[model samples]
Target chain A: MGVTGRAKRGKTEGPILKKCSTGIKGLDEITGGGLPQGRPTLVCGGTGCGKTLLAMEFLLRGALNYGEPGVFMSFEEKPDELVQNYASLGFDLEGLVAQHRLVLEYVYIERSEIEETGEYDLEALFIRLGHAIDSIGAKRVVLDTVEALFSGFSNESILRAELRRLFRFLKSKGVTAIITGEQGERTLTRYGLEEYVADCVIFLNHTVSDQIATRHLRIIKYRGSSHGTNEYPFLIDQQGFSVMPITSLGLDHPAFTERISTGIPRLDTMLGGEGYFRGSSILVSGTAGTGKSSMAAHFVDGACSRGERCLYFAFEESQNQIIRNMRSIGIDLEQWVKKGLLRFHNTRPSLYGLEMHLVALHKEVERFDPAVVVVDPISNLVTAAAPKEVKAMLSRLIDYLKLKRITAFCTDLTSAGGGILEQTEVGVSSLMDAWLLLQNIEGSGERNRGLYILKARGIAHSNQIREFFLTDRGIALRDVYVGPGGVLTGTARIAQEARDAAASTLHRQEIERKQRELERKKKTVDAQIIALKTEYELEREELQQAVAQERLRDDVVMKESMEMARARQADAVPTTAGGKQGRGGRKR
Target chain B: MIAAEGKRVHNGDGEQWILRLYVAGQTPKCLTAFANLKKICEEHLAGQYRIEIIDLLVHPELAKGDQILALPTLVRKLPEPVKKIIGDLSNTEKVLVGLDIRPFK
Candidate 1:
């Protein structure tokens, strides 16, 4: 089916169904535009469900914003009471009346004073309403709790007939009207006035869940128009009624590639050396005392240091408490607050329902128009609503922040005992663009904080776990030190590092001893070679001297032998010893 | 109605009943209601009653004073405790009872 119409500001289209803007935040989008134009819409709810206020706001907004005159005919409250009630909400009803832009008609009825005698019609009511409308030339009308007529009159059939005529008369006069009724147990309204005002039906509900009052608005039906059927949570505070349409926003927010700092240089290094992407949702989850708030403070500090506005929502701590605590860690948040670059919104989770918290966050973000938003420990919000609801609210919030291209840094406190520190109980981890898991590495009789990037989309983040310390200076991330057991931290890492240093020293001493032993062995081998060379030289000299002595003796012997031979009648030829000559001849 | 009106004796200084009949215009129901109210006042109240006709169509703003919603509404203005009766006074017995005249009769 096609949409009946879309309400555009200051513009109209042809033939489908023309819409009137309700001039309410997040309401016009849900109603597909506004109530079917020039037709009476039935708004039914239980007492104190804001039906009267809704109708009054419609008429007031019509008069103020849409430049359309309005007439408010109240059957439940007096004009003075209404004016006073609306005055607190900053609506100038009396001023509007003075300007002839609005007319407030109070229909007072006392059943005890009236006696019904015979046949009659509610022509006076019609005339009164018509006169009020004509007096201002109103294009919008509000009959707040018109079903009160049922109690004041005895004839139901005539009242019903007249109500039908009243609606027709309103349509004929081209005045878009809102007719409120008290909710019935089964039917949409007590008097079944929905049957008469069939053009549109809106149901307001004020229900208490876990003792938290949440107001919701649902469009039951709209003739010739399509409207949001989901019950959008609405808030009625000083700003009046504001409906929050959870699924109204689509996933069409523009993506930004700009990166911002996470405040800690090492943490930024872990996140691909730059920080979170602009317009990204960052989740920093950890157990208690794991410095989740500190991480968020750093993010806010980073944004403010860059001269960008930051909105910090502290659920667990007050503004002064956070400021003082961060000051202890050497981060002066008060200066940022003083400079108007940082804003702290502190509220307890139990102060409102999940939707109310979302509305407040939305209001703050819109008012501040911050470049970065930080919610320190969103896990506290689980106490206000269910995990699923918290996730839904966070999803809408992240979507809103992303649409505005605001960097959102939210800290979540994971339950410690038996609860996985890696798992965010609210299950909002998947909704975040970057998730930093802070855990307590309990070992060596002490607990130490460890931080690791679980996920960082579109960036190459570090996979190593860095031991983080919350020191007096700031949060410091140490490089991972793997020991015999695992990644050691605190004194265990220190002890292991000390042991490694000692072992390296022993190794250096052992190498020095081996070098001395090798030097001694080389010297001894050199001395032995010198001694052997000297001994061998002496032996050779002695052998040569012996041969020389033998030779000299032999010569002396030959000379003596020759002289003997000469003396013994030896020939003139050189004589040799007979035995020597015979031996030489025999040897030859 | 005449017998009942004659049987009651009017008492007190505020006994004069000043009734105002509010109507948008001269419709049949308005005329019938005015006629019936006049006849009932003359019979039941005699000389102690007075009827005032207020056309809401002519003086529409005056309807807020009597809190008039239905046409041809009768309001007992002069009595100590004012009373209001709605609808055309077709049933004189009910109308007399509403006016607190010949109520038991």
Candidate 2:
């Protein structure tokens, strides 16, 4: 950090606006590596919105992490009060003050005492700040509610002019400073300090939505550096202030070719033989009691089998409940939980806002370093916030998971009170790389669960609607049985198969009977044909004999005639006229 | 009003001791300053002194007029020269000496 700061400072005489890291979680990323270095950032908020804490954290973390001493000038709270208040967050203000690393200058002005009697130049405050900065060589300053001092001043113009001068003086001192202010009725701050300090302005808001309080931090405006403009939800816990910057890291995640199983072999088959892509997001959408959680448990068990970590976020069920429930289904999730391979994070959906869940989810994912993440029935989040906020939160969550290359499988219980199937209130399927839709096909006095892949972005996935049954062994998907009745399921399929088998047997018997009748008729026709052929042969033989006898008799008569003719011709050779007359008589 | 001469307000007829207390509102410090100034005046100046309490929040322009900066500043207008003491005047010796009622120890 010092190197970066020195590089920026030495490059030019003009202040090179370098970004300083605020060490607080998500704040640096939100501000694209923190506030502008050596520039005063205006931190304004309403009462109880954590403005002072924000400022104090910037200075404390600046000292702790970046090795830069900081100065805290409190205009509202006394130094002791500031120290006591921040002690809850592990910020050792007194220790730092004793070490001369942090200088706490309490500049509490009595609202009823101080009179703006003259055109004062704020020289006293400036002297104190310069003195503190010099004493510690501080590089950061926190002016906590500095505007409160203006309440004693009746002269608005001089105070305004002096505040501007104060920021410029701080900038010139080359200290990155945060000035806290009360939220104004119409402007960003009560006195509109934002108009003067334009380098950066942050707004902290604490509002109760649906009886649950949520704290939001937004970078209202940042000059010369790109910052997250969205209102990020933040939390104040034992670790101080943490702002959840949803989607501050954009959607440019590295696509991975690695794949993990969906826990169930059939499910893997449905998802193109392997599981989801390593960095892919898969959504299991189904109706009530469609084995979505079972599918998730299977995936968790599979990850645990691979000796990889898995984080299970259950919004609707507790850890023990999930473990016990999954145990009943032959998936011994408690074993993995005991093995520390699976971590269950359970929270009530109505406990906080959607962003709060997102923040918790991000923290748990990071803490566990899970290879796969499963949020059972993410559709319950629809109850946590507005549909749009829920979808936005989920989009951010999915983007984060994909960026980490952790295969994520989230279940959505497509609410029963819907007109369509596999339609979640959040409508997040578009962001998913694979969608496995489970449905309850209830017919013929029974309900059967069916699982199918609606789409798999890559690889050849089965288009068959497989009937999945949950039993003591686990979930099993039946092979697709598509007949003339299209896709069949449950007893109807069994019944139809029975009917088809019976009809085929009957058809076989009918065909055999017809074949036997055809054989008998062929035998009768052969006998009748034999009898007719014998009679035809006898008659043909008699006719042929009669024709042969006639031919023989004709031949004998011709031969005799030829002999007689020859003898007559020889005897009557001399008498040609008589021979011709005898030949004509014979021809007659 | 321009009173370059401090005693001109009394017309020099045994001159009324004029003391002005600058305050923002009726804060505790301002009340403390007022009480101390009254006690000092009652012990020394008696009935011959006139005290003026100017709330600067009511009149901000007066600040530029008198060149005042700190809060609860007690200004002595009489005795030819004006002297100022900042804070709630909690240190009585400092306040007494600053007002020229007594010399500094």
Candidate 3:
């Protein structure tokens, strides 16, 4: 069939691109609906950059989420070690094994005792892999750091040949394989295996820039597939590795036709219409005490009031603390919690790894299946991980929520003088779909809160900053009244203005006083300059006289030497007479 | 078990006997097949019994090994030899009857 005609025919036959869901939250979006099915993908990374975690998560998600059996061939860690390592993340590998959904094989190659008998080949290894794959009929297989085969044999040619054979075998067997390679400096792998035998190559990097270490993943190459080319920041928390491929979703996903309220009518009015679109991510960034969390809670209450489930993940406050604080502002989340429409996931920032946090979030989201998810203060999460990791996690979380059509609202705490759109740690400001900025503005001798919509994707939002207030009733928005300075230059700017006024007054007084002192000092300096110039001229004349004296001394010395030589020659006149006598004696 | 046949031949019984031996792999018990057959021929059968030795290791595709599921098993086939013996063929009398070589009364 002609290519275009075949493609047109394939449209009626459904998608020919077979997909294997990565089981990771945002990874599927970056991979264009996961890794290409029945092909080996090379996942290469440095130690602890989460190659193993990603592999395990792939297997776990395959078994648990997709009902596909998986096999894990570990070269360094045993099955028990993997099980124990993933226990905290709540991935029960052993349970999966017992359920016949997963299998783990440890391939140990002892370099000390390995004697090459000239008759052995990699056929035994292949046999064992085949046996494991057949035993469970695994559709997904992960060989964690298969480069250990090189440790037992110094023959690079053999290792390369065998690995090529292995990849071909896996491909022929129609298993989606992930062979992890240890990342090397300046290269994807030690032996550059990524260049040879694989259909895809993914590079994982754990870089520490500005003292904040973050994990990032990049899809270097994937044959016959279109993938996101962005370097996705990933988090390794208690859950596992979650790549945040934010803003990479196609517009083909179903959109909500309904508009939801923001719980507070005045705040809703500030949204230029009524609330945000369902499945949209709302980022609320502000300095401390700007009522960002309170605004987020207002949205959560709005969702709960409508009988929709809302999940609140608080990184900055405990459930009781949030409830108590919000109660003073008339947001009683306890009632929603009692009605089973609201759930709170409060965790300390240092409690787990970034991937673990992603896992926890995944589990909570899966269990609750809330219509709205709120993360109060995503900035605290940034403290636990790098900016890239936080962005990656947020991307995954956002993608997961978008897939489920859940509206997500997250609050980020920014420094007092920082811009609303600038991210402090990893600079991931471009990833947010909708950004809201809250500030404490100084008006009429008191600090009044202000709100502004910085950016909202796919929707028109007001660019004007609105004056807002938080009271016992709830959050209220008012019309922004611009004064001498622009609106939204909040209390810090006022404080700076006041400080500048005082400093300017003091500066005028000080400058006058300093002007008087400078007049006196200048008079003294002028006198000194005059005296110094006079002394400099006198010193110059003295130096000129000294040079003349030295020249005269040199001339006198030269004259004395010349005169002495002349006197010596005159004194040697008897010697000339002796010479004449010797000459006459020689002639005789 | 019934006593089916009794035969005694000093020089030749004019009958060929088929024998089979089962073994797991190359082990001591698997190696003693030739020696045991030689002793049985020199002492009892002389030129009467024809013995065939089978190594289960090389010919695992053969079904006789799994049918008995015994290692180092010997089965006498001819000269009315209807009995089977397991183990290393150490006991001579049991093996003699196992090959239908008991003395006639």
Per-residue C-alpha lDDT of model 1 across residues A1-588, encoded as one tens digit per residue: 134334442134546777888898888988878878888888999999999889989988899899999999988788899889999999999999999999989998889888998889999998899899889899999998788898899999999899889998999999899999999989999889988988889999988878888888999989887777888888898889888887777789999999999999998888889988999999999888999889988888888999999999989899999999999898999999999999999999999888889989998998999999999888899889778778878988999999999998999888889567778989999899999999988888988889999999999999999998998889999976887687799999888889989999999999999999999999999999999999999999999999899768767876786788778885665455564785467547
TM-score of each: 0.83, 0.80, 0.57
Candidate 3's residue-wise lDDT over A1-588, tens digit each?
599998887775876668899879778978888988998999998888889889889988998998889999888998789999999899888999999999888776555433231112354456567767877899999998788888866556766787888888999889998889998788889878886655789989887644556678899998767888878778876667677665585445677756678787865665667767777778888888989889988998888988999999998788999999999998899999999999999998767666567768878998999999998878888767766667777776777787789888888888876554355344545656778888777655667788877877766667777877677888877676565655534464556567779999999999999999999999999999999999999999999999899768756765665577677775544434554565567547
iRMS of every model, one decimal?
A: 0.8, 11.0, 16.1
Q: What is the C-alpha RMSD of each candidate to the true structure, in Å?
A: 7.6, 9.1, 28.7
Give candidate 1's whole-model lDDT: 0.88
Over 4 Å off in model 3, which ranges?
A: A1-29, A32-39, A50-108, A114-146, A169-176, A207-214, A233-244, A251-257, A267-285, A350-359, A386-403, A417-437, A443-445, A450-470, A475-588, B1-105
lDDT of 2 by residue, B1-105 (tens): 123223343465554678887787777778887887788777766666888888766665464444455666667787657666666666666666666666645
Candidate number with greatest DockQ: 1
The best candidate by lDDT is 1
Better of 1 and 3 by lDDT: 1
**C-alpha lDDT of all candidate models, in order:** 0.88, 0.81, 0.75
Clashing pairs in 1: none
Kindly indicate the candidate among 1 and 3 with the higher DockQ: 1
The order of the candidates by lDDT, greatest first, is 1, 2, 3
